[model samples]
Target: MLPKCIGNLSTTLTAFSSGGNRVFGEIPEEIGNFVNLEVLFMNLNQLSGVIPSNLGNLRNLARLDLSDNNMGGTIPSSLGNLTKLIGLSLSGNNFRGQIPSQLSNCRSLDSLDLSSNNLGGAIPPQLIGLSSFAIILDLSRNHLTGVLPKEVGNLRALTALDISDNLLVGEVPSSLGACIGLTSLRMGGNFFHGSIPQSIRLLGGIEELDISRNNLSGQIPEFLAVLHSLKILNLSYNKFEGMLPREGVFKNVTSTFIIGNNELCGGLPEFHLPDCISKSSKSKKINIVILSTCIIFGVLGVAVILAFIYLCWLKKKVNKPVPSLINSSCPNISYGELLKATDSFSSTNLIGVGSCGSVYKGILKDSGIAVAVKVFHLVHHGALKSFTVECEALKTIKHRNLLKILTVCSSIDYQGNDFKAIVYEFMDNGSLERWLHPSATSSHGNELPKKLNFIRRISIAIGVASALDYLHHQCHFPILHCDLKPSNILLDAKMVVHLGDFGLAKFLLGSSHDTVANQMSSMGLRGSVGYAPPEYAMGCEVSREGDVYSYGILLLEMFTGLSPTDNRFGDNLTLHSFVAAALPERVLEVTDRIPLLARASVWESLVPMKCLKNG
Candidate 1:
């Protein structure tokens, strides 16, 4: 017996199970006092009498199982109160009377089994139409009567259904075809009559079908042979007649079992069935004439369909607009047009080499709009993937600090080889790398030595930070800039920084709180050697913290005018250590003298000597 003292525990208890035990006698009424219980299992026991109606108090209950017991009585209608119940099983018991229509209130029920009981009365139409019944619905070996409800079609996700061995009458509901996912259907040992519905052909995924021992009449459908997934079909002890189909699963004798149908004949020779005799000559002539007429009409229909399709294709070609870019709202340019604008990719038009490809300066012939075209080298590893990633990243993101893609070209070149490129608004001032370390020999006639003041450097840093912040927090998906260095940062005519080069970008699928260990990456280590985080070398996953480390290094390089890759630092000394050692006393020793002297007055106002002395 369930101890009455068990109910004395705290109301916080959420589960109580006493199944498969020798425990007997009436369940103590106090058992229902655990109002907070969400799961109550007392199956496989000898507990008798009706289920406690007070169980309705568990409004938060999600599962209740009481099968294989000696309990006798009508199912408690109070179970309807479990609005959150996802599974309810009360099969293999002595419970009788009509199934409670109140069960329809369990809108969350996915699996329900009330089989092997003495349940009587018509099956509730509301219960049959419960859309949440996705897993299984077993009401077999019951005493249910009357026609099967048409509402059974509502179980679109149900995989298995067993309503066999019942007292149900009338034809099986044709709407059962709506259960397209059904893998097994058992309706045997019933009083169902009439020919099997033609809609049964729609159960293309059915693997097992049992409709034996029924009052069903008419010839077995030839369409049954075409259900490729069917493995076992049992039509024994039925009133089906006529010759059996010889194709598909029907050809295998062991897979199909049909017995006690005396009128059936002419199956495989293994069945030892009598041969079907030929019809009279007059009937043969009629069949030949019908077959010849059908062939003529079928040929004419095919020719007509082909001619109509050809006419539609010709019409579409004549009126089709010029081939444009992916986003049709923008101006369109073809591959040949871009090639001519770039002077056939001449060496004079070359701008710079990137991670995946080379950049070329070009001007549109009609509009004369200067643009930078990046052509990807398909043979290089990860080159195509980088182009695809960059395109996808730029399409959904837009900001003043982010590079804008004017258009893209995905077509064949003059030599018939594949070509892929992206065009973007030209940055006249070139990359931050060129600005920081000017080349002695200039290719472009307008090339001039450029320098950034202290204030300009701060503004550029703020712009890059704003772009990174948007990518990490504001977007629908977080984007990680795997590479963050001076070369990837561009400056326009006004010296406004624009973050570009998303070739190695990664979009995180998880939330911000997820640990770096849980993140995934196909590229091994990210960022350049000195700028990359220390954890990256250890094969640890990448995170936003890695980007912050790179930014910190970049900031240090800006003020010190020393690259992290400079040969001055060797085994023991790094850029970080070098900057750390030169603190308050020797700070000006490592500073960039040219820019520092130009902004001396601003530096004095920004950083007082007293603050450095106190530190």
Candidate 2:
């Protein structure tokens, strides 16, 4: 609730901010009297009701942010009156109806965000395609539909543009390539079709690009590999085909994602795809026609004999039993060794418990090396299968940030009962869950502190991102850790992250990112409550997007020191919404006190105050 008395300061006040508070109620129309105000921020609050049209009266306002509120109704066309405005953010709200085309009048504006709202209808070409945006222009996660106008090329100074997760249709315009300054471009999760525009080759400085989960078809462009500045690329779940180029970004398997394109073949050996048939091979086969008739007949006779021999070999293979594990290279450890290491599964050694099993801390008898032994409860419905799936996932992928499997044991115990366990290098720092909520979950004698500082949290996040990037792109078969939570994130003595727990992991079959090899066998909810994406609860199949959603929640929890299942969260309010309500301005208030105590001025220093004032 802003006080109406503040209006009296309209002539003297240069800036006013009431963001990231629990303030509610409509903004008083008297606020429009602030003719001298240069900056106004009321974001991340509970404010309801329509925006006051009178706000446009602030001709001097250079920066305005009223995002992440409950404000609804059409955006006032009066906003176009702020011809001097440079930045405007009205995202994550209930605002509905078409965007006002009159906004194009803000000729000086360089940054704008209208994402994550109910705003629909065709994008106003005049407002977007004609703007001389220099920083960022994000209109994603809305219901907006229609073709992206070619006039968008006018924003040649823009560095980032995102229109993903919308209903946008039609081919991407070639004119978009004219925005050569763009470093990040995302147009995924749309209805876009046809080939990627050839003009994109002009965007030599582009770093990150995502156009996945669309109707896009055609061979992936070779120019993408030549874009040396390109670091992250996602072209999955489309209709791309033909040989994948082996140069530049394509050679770095971890940075590129291209699954769900069945016709694609021939890249690095890591992709495990069939060799591409060259034109020379076809010419050689046709040359056989020039051979003598007797030679052709002799070739047909040899083929028949080889076919019979192949049939006999196939018959022998059919009778052979299939091996349970895909990887047999792992050293086998017996039940006796595990019993000696874990002290006969002593309760004193138990460190953690999960859906499929319990983890025990142990030291190998011979090497005296510390390890964490995960012993599955075979009595549990899916425990045996979970063990097998984990083993296969671990053996197939190797990454620095991923937990390393030391050995595995699969044999009968003294009671003649089945025993299965996996050994991993012990993480001395323990799970991220313990550190984030130390008071609630930390074990006695745990030496780690309750709060992680700013630099530490960022490092952990980067480590986790690297591990996920490898699993989703670099692996021969993309793996989805259906369950990603703070508990699954471990840290070593050096505080480096190690992502563990693959009990519910799913392997994408063939080249389809959405089709799992054993989906039916692992049916039901795909992840832990609170962390799982909403679609999983609706019976949707597992997807890479789902893992990303869980990761987002985990990241929020890490910095906020609040769990997704925190008692404070309710039906409408979530960890996501709570954070959304206090971004940029109230960020420090919602942040875990640990980081702020270490350094309070970090975030404030990052704000581009010069741009806000000069523009």
Q: Best by lDDT, which number?
A: 2
lDDT (Cα, 0-100) at 516 in candidate 2: 17
Q: Which stretches of candidate 2 lie over 4 Å from their true place?
A: 283-615
User: Over the stretch 114-167, how does candidate 1's per-residue lDDT look in tens digits?
Assistant: 987667678999999998898999997666768899999999999999987676
Q: How many clashing pairs in candidate 1?
A: 0
In model 1, the runs with Cα more than 4 Å from the true position are 1-328, 440-446, 511-523, 605-615
Q: What lDDT would each prediction earn against the true structure?
A: 0.80, 0.84
RMSD of 1: 27.3
Span of ten consecutive residues with least summed lDDT in model 1: 512-521
Candidate 2 residue-wise lDDT, 498-572, digit = tens: 999987898886543222125223335778999999988888888899999999998999888899999999999
Which residue pairs overlap in candidate 1's backbone?
none
